[model samples]
Target: MKRTPFGAWPCSIARAVDLLGDWWTPLVLREAVFGVRRFEEFQRHLGIGRNVLAQRLNRLVDEGLMDRVPYQDRPLRHEYVLTDKGRDFFPVLAAIIAWGDTWLSDDEGAPVVLRHRTCGHETRAVVACAECGDPLRIEDMEALAGPGLRTAGTAGTARTAGTAEGEPTAAAADSP
Candidate 1:
């Protein structure tokens, strides 16, 4: 079946999900963040099929989240390195890890713990308001219309009406 593209959606979340929502992409990114640079290494770490690994790497490169750098001249082998945009995605991965460790871990506890090298302390990721430096909780947050928002009959609105249930309403999905 053909996949419905979400890249052009007005919602930043939707666009991000479009790029990274697949099961393998985030794992590949996690490996990259953990210093897995080579194709063989990613495959071995992920236990993913070679073809799928290649596809995910290519997609990440195309999306500007990763840079494919030539490492070997003889056979032209390349290494995948995270770009600035990809590095910026680290917090998202941290949040995912935090959630998993909290909700899904066994009684033995989280298999991994993130420690800060500079502070020499273990840390957990938390979302905070940029302006106030206060932790942001879902109940404390409110959505407001932004500059890129569009109403019905407005020009440059890319989304169509009648999206499936559980999807963001058009008015709530403002372009970024």
Candidate 2:
């Protein structure tokens, strides 16, 4: 069997792992999205070492996913704030939570359910067809390479066409 270097693959998922791929990274993002912004907060919440937390925060800031803001002047204290790029990850987090709840949870349902403010009911994250409002299925998609995707293959190409472009293509329409 042929083997490929894990990092050598030109895929978005692989690239994402290279950047935010640490086992601790997603937990850090999870805390950040849930309003834990301070270095101390992250350390406390995740029980991560101060050094590791600092490194992750610095990396996130360098990637433009987070920004450091001074919250206290006397001690030169700062807090991390999510940038638009970081804020945009809410859907990704929601999908992850939904999956874990479905597949990993015991008899309990989702640990925390999302309730839409407009409608008084629980909501599951849905990516639907804009034109016909139909729910999207894994088969209902394709991927077309962009500049970033020039080198990515299977892993880099998880961005489904219908989801990325918000329109069903001929291939998507062919799904039974």
Candidate 3:
């Protein structure tokens, strides 16, 4: 569960994958975000085993992406709701939907459309800079080492920029 270093090649992808990469995890989050709060509801919608659904929900709560609320007094039934961090994943889910609509849709149009309540218009997910309102592309961003950086020599040759084979760049100190 340890996080790999930033600025490392594929580090962002790896961290994201580590956090919510599994086949069931995103679906669980999808259900939670979409208001499928009850355990039975998730089980029915996903057709996942009760035990697997239980584990995914527990993991989300442990990770602080979800809050468990009491739904029934007797025997304490509960429903899971998204935390702020979980809500922040809306863009990620939208992107996933976009990707599916592009590559997996049977028809040219999307299977399910997301409409803005205020505008009454269907919208697509966009990645944009908050300050500039500029759309972000892969090449528009740069990843820098954060508070986790360590000296390249001491950390590993994985950080040597000119390392002969299978080495990480100098900018990527903690990449292994």
Candidate 4:
């Protein structure tokens, strides 16, 4: 089935979703973040078919998330290394992991524990107010319009998570 392209959407989230494509892309990225660089390694870890893995890697490379570097001089083999943009995606992944650990963990609890290299302590990701460093809570916030808000198209008032189009965004000055 043909998929709608969201890269042109005014919302950054939509554009990111379009670029990430599907489960394979993020899984591939997860591996890349964990230092899995080569094609064969990604395949082994993900259990994704060769063609599909190739496709996802190529898309990531095309999207500037990963760089294909020549790793072997003899066979011209390459490894997929995360670019700066890709490395920057860690927070987003960390947020996802945090959410999963909170709501989706089974009887054994979270499968992974993230540790800070500098502090040498295990920690979970936290989404907080960047300006004041307060943890974000839905009740403590309000939605506000943004410059990209499709103008009369919308600067919607919904402070809800991306449940619908035109969800709210908070500005530094925004107060509930």
- Per-residue lDDT of model 2, residues 1-176, tens digit only: 76344556556677567777678888899899889988888999999998888899998999888999999999899999999989987887888888888898888667878777798898777778889999878666656666655644433433454354666566655689
For residues 67-129, could you state the per-residue lDDT of candidate 4 as single tens digits?
A: 999989997899989999999999989988999999999999999889999999999888899
Off by over 4 Å in 3: 1-12, 150-176
Best by lDDT: 1
lDDT of 4: 0.85
Tens-digit lDDT string for candidate 3 (1-176): 97554434334575667778679999999888788999999999999999989999998898889999998999989999999988988889999898898889986678889998899999888879999999876534544454333434224222232354565444555445
- Ten residues in sequence with the least summed lDDT for candidate 2: 151-160
RMSD (CA, angstroms), candidate 2: 6.4
TM per candidate: 0.84, 0.74, 0.75, 0.84
Candidate 1 overall lDDT versus native: 0.87
The lowest-lDDT stretch of 10 consecutive residues in candidate 1 is 152-161
Model 2 reaches what TM-score against the true structure? 0.74
**Distance (Å) between predicted and true CA of 79, model 1?**
0.3
The TM-score, computed over Cα atoms with residue i paired to residue i, of candidate 1 is 0.84
| lDDT to native, each model | 0.87, 0.80, 0.79, 0.85
Q: What is the lDDT of residue 123 in candidate 3?
A: 88
Q: Which pairs of residues have clashing backbones in candidate 3?
A: none
Would you give me the overall lDDT of model 2?
A: 0.80
| Backbone clash tally (model 3) | 0
User: Quick one: ranking by lDDT, best first?
Assistant: 1, 4, 2, 3
